[model samples]
Target: MRRALTWVVMVAVGIFAAVGLWSAAVDPAPVSAEETAREVSQSLRCPTCAGESIADSSAMLSDAMRQTVDQQVRQGRSADEIRAWFAERYGDQVLLAPPRSGYGWVLWVAPLALVGAAAVVVLLVGGTSTRRRWWAALLVLAVTSLAGVWLLVPQTTPDPQRLKQEDPPQVNAVAVLRDAVDHAPGNAGLRIAFAGALEEVGQDAEAVEAYAAATRLRPLDSDVRYRHAFALVRSDDPGAAREVLEESLHVRQDHAPSLLLLGALVHGEDPDRASALLQQFVQLAPEHPAVDQVTAFLAGQLDEVPAEALP
Candidate 1:
């Protein structure tokens, strides 16, 4: 029995040492841009499709989303930051990963709890004849538990100084726009510029307000109305966007952007009208960057396009 236990100890120590050496010798391979884009896209729902990841969808909107992920990855943004950016534009439903707050903790904790309970049961119910084997199993379990704890624990605390160094303060673009609008209260161009800047910064609600002001100031301006409608769509008010786009169409019947945006906004609820609008957009803007996407939508071939064909 002494000889058997000594052999077991030697084997266990040898295994641990081998594992350590292997880990120390191995370096993780760097992920490629396409690989990073795919990984990030897998975590995001396609903005224009139901029940599909952006990585899996071929719609133009999904293609745009994947490109956004690729750009963010290339810029060295964390996965969490990319997810947050999408959530800001598309809402929390866009994320496949559950939020860390609330019931999300349950999913993270349950697996470790089960492993620990299994370890305890093995310790309590094993027979004496298998004592050595059980001891070895327990030793393995202890190592696994330590590893799990290390992985699950938060690795770093937020340092205010480090954060300041990493992200130097950016000028408040919206605030500057607001000041410009104040100085030129009656300038419709100033209001439209302010709205565009707000939209770029993910202030969709404020952007809608600024766009509305510009639209009211220049009700006959097809471009201003089209921009206002686009802002409304971004702000999650698609119905209002449709109304504004219809009015813009009344002002300029061949406005391609308004037709395209309106078609996208109403596709789910009014496919026939959406198709007509998309067809009109294609006819009016045959050389536009989005023409291929609109043509695919009209032909019902968007779902058949491969993701690689997008960008």
Candidate 2:
């Protein structure tokens, strides 16, 4: 019986080690926009909605928040950077995920420590053979259950409401951009710069307007048109985006960025055309940073290529 129990423990340990090794060896699937948005939102509270995560809320503000998360994720920002962006705008209260510092560490550590201590105490206690068997069984069950839960369950930190708060320092990029735009109102370059700053700050609608202005000032510039179309897509006007991208292609037939963006915009509604455009883009810009993602996407390995990977 003792040998049998030892073998059972060894099997469990081997299974756990194999799982750990497999997880370490396998590359995580690229995160899709919706999944990335949902994951970020799960860590954030809806600023305009009460008692709900941004992921769970349908309020317009929550929608904007989700878009910001999606944009940041596509831009390859880390989760901490995205959280910091929200915290800058809405205070630390915007985060549902508790900081891992201070007392927060205790909440995570104490439970597992208690389980370990309990098991140790059970093994150390002097008892009858039946009692020893019972204790051993309980210990095994407890350890197995806890290990399963730790591996399978997504662990959320304690509620942010209960933790101490610190406000993030703010940078008023919009005001700086506005000042620069005012100084050179006719400069298409300045306007594009302003638009990019606005997009970074989660002001998608304003970014679209700024991009439109830049495109108007440089109507013959295919690059400006591509930027405008990309901004339009981010603002959820894919039809208009398509028209602008087509105009860009008319201006410069080999404009790789426009082709790539257009492909992504139409990927859902017209996959054949999208695939052709993406293939053309790959041929035109083989050395571009987005090529790997596009290749992965074309090969059915990824759901979508991130926007930041584009020029």
Residue by residue across 1-311, what tens digits does model 1's lDDT show? Answer: 56765765676666666655555455232368676677677777654455566787775445545655766777788777877776665556666555554575565566766667766666677667578366646655455644444344432223434433342222344554465476456767767777877778798998898889988899899889988887776677878988998999999999888888877777778888888887888788888777786777678887432223221
The positional error of residue 121 in candidate 2, measured at the CA in angstroms, is 79
- CA lDDT of every candidate: 0.67, 0.73
Q: Candidate 2: which stretches are off by over 4 Å?
A: 1-171, 302-311
Against the true structure, candidate 1 reaches a TM-score of 0.43
Cα-based TM-score, every candidate: 0.43, 0.43
Candidate 1's C-alpha runs over 4 A off are 1-171, 303-311
- What lDDT is reached at residue 166 by model 2? 32
TM-score, structure 2 vs. true? 0.43
Pairs that collide in candidate 1 are none
